[model samples]
Target: MLWGCFSSAGTGKLVRIEGKMDGAKYREIIEENLMQSAKDLRLGRRFIFQQDNDPKHTARATKEWFGLKNVNVLKWPSQSPDLNPIENLWQDLKIAVHRRSPSNLTELHLFCQEEWTNLSISRCAKLVETYPKRLAAFNGKPGDLIVINRLAYHHWAIYIGENEVVHLDPEGGDSSSSLELLSFRGEVKRQKLTDLVANDSYQVKNLLDQRYRARDHYVIVKEASSMVGRQLSYNDDTYNSQHFARDLRYGEAESRQVRRAACPAWAGLAAARAATNDFSDRRLLYRSLKRLSK
Candidate 1:
């Protein structure tokens, strides 16, 4: 296999590896290639390394080496290839090499080196420029669904495009009340997406329609809009934001009977078990939630 690093300016160093890479060898490559690249680009301490969650890349020894070097690495999403711009560069290089149709492994290596050198800084910069938009696109879309964890509770909302989401808020008071609650402070209301997500961790809960058949987008928005001024009673065991979301998406009330059986402190886990009916996998859920909290 081959390993390499690149930045917005161009390719850094390319290393050819004949076999598996262990933590020590991986650390050596990073120290040699990345450190030199940092110096060449004059990035110094400001350069942040990016790597996928490969076993060698994330091994304890490799992490310790990065710590000793005081190099900052970008926290990358696991199993997300599209988030890595270098993947695109790899694809381009592969295409270029294949077009030459080298007759032997030696020729192939030479072609790879030539193609890597030919990659322009302007092309790399364009890829880097798309990073922010790519992140935004990954985060959400219009009419997209989101689930936010607010400590012991979870809330649901529907994105309405342009950095805004509408959700059913119990604190907004009943539709008949004339008092206006503070922004995101009460009731079913529309709030800036940032405000809703502020100080909270969220997950994109949509796009799992095959696993949990979601309602039509128009229906979801209509249901959300209709509930805007209505004050829904909040009952942790029976009805709440989560249940509201379930009702809108699945047309069924979320049963919290199992959660009710447990103490409020353990309700989250109990509810998850009730929903999945897989006690053995509860630890996985806990682990995922713990990781997201960090």
Candidate 2:
């Protein structure tokens, strides 16, 4: 067996594993090669170490080794195949080493090392550059609520899988300026999550799941997908980004931001009752009452 890693910086140390591999031997390989590889690749402090959830990789000793080194290991998803860019390099290395036709173990090791080094830095960078799309690919199951934090406020969407989301994009499409998101007319649009997120940070946040039961995943996805390309006049008090996502996930449209800004403190319980009773269509009436009471 063999072990290796790569980054936008370049390929890391490649080690040939002998005999049956276990936790101790796996830790030994990482201890011997990981730090040196990081230094050689010029990856400064704060680089996240990613590895599969193999039994040996997640063993107690391995966890201790990382803790001792203060390495920030990425929490890999269970049952998910490793999608690190190094997988692509492995394929290329196999083809190149095969052409040499090594006859012995010693020759095979030598050819593997040579081919690993021959992998181009540009190719490594391109892989890393396009990695985000793949990173978001399995983040959420279908119909899961996803949130993008745009500094001032959060943009909400429902994951329909394949790195795409069902979201309400402003009529002119998303704007680079965060302020523009405060108020705008929008339409339900199916867009790539990466394209919608741009440089902003996002995560799968199935918020309020404890308070409100999530609808059937297939039903949520089907209903949300059906709204694609439908126009919506943006109204924080009635229907907004968060409301749309919540409606799909929970069969109720409730925006905490809108309630806090537009509703009175005395009306909190009443507002909750309204949401539970499916009085969403009467939100405009409630908003007018809030204004009058204030």
**TM-scores of the models, in the given order?**
0.48, 0.48
Which window of ten consecutive residues has the lowest lDDT sum in model 1?
Answer: 177-186
Residues 115-234, candidate 2: write the lDDT tens digits.
999899998998889777767654678889888877444678898876578987544333334343234466799876656665456788997787777888999889988999887766
- Could you tell me the TM-score of candidate 2? 0.48
List per-prediction Cα lDDT, in the order shown: 0.65, 0.74
Off by over 4 Å in 2: 138-294
Q: Candidate 1 overall Cα lDDT vs. reference?
A: 0.65
lDDT of 1 at 286: 47
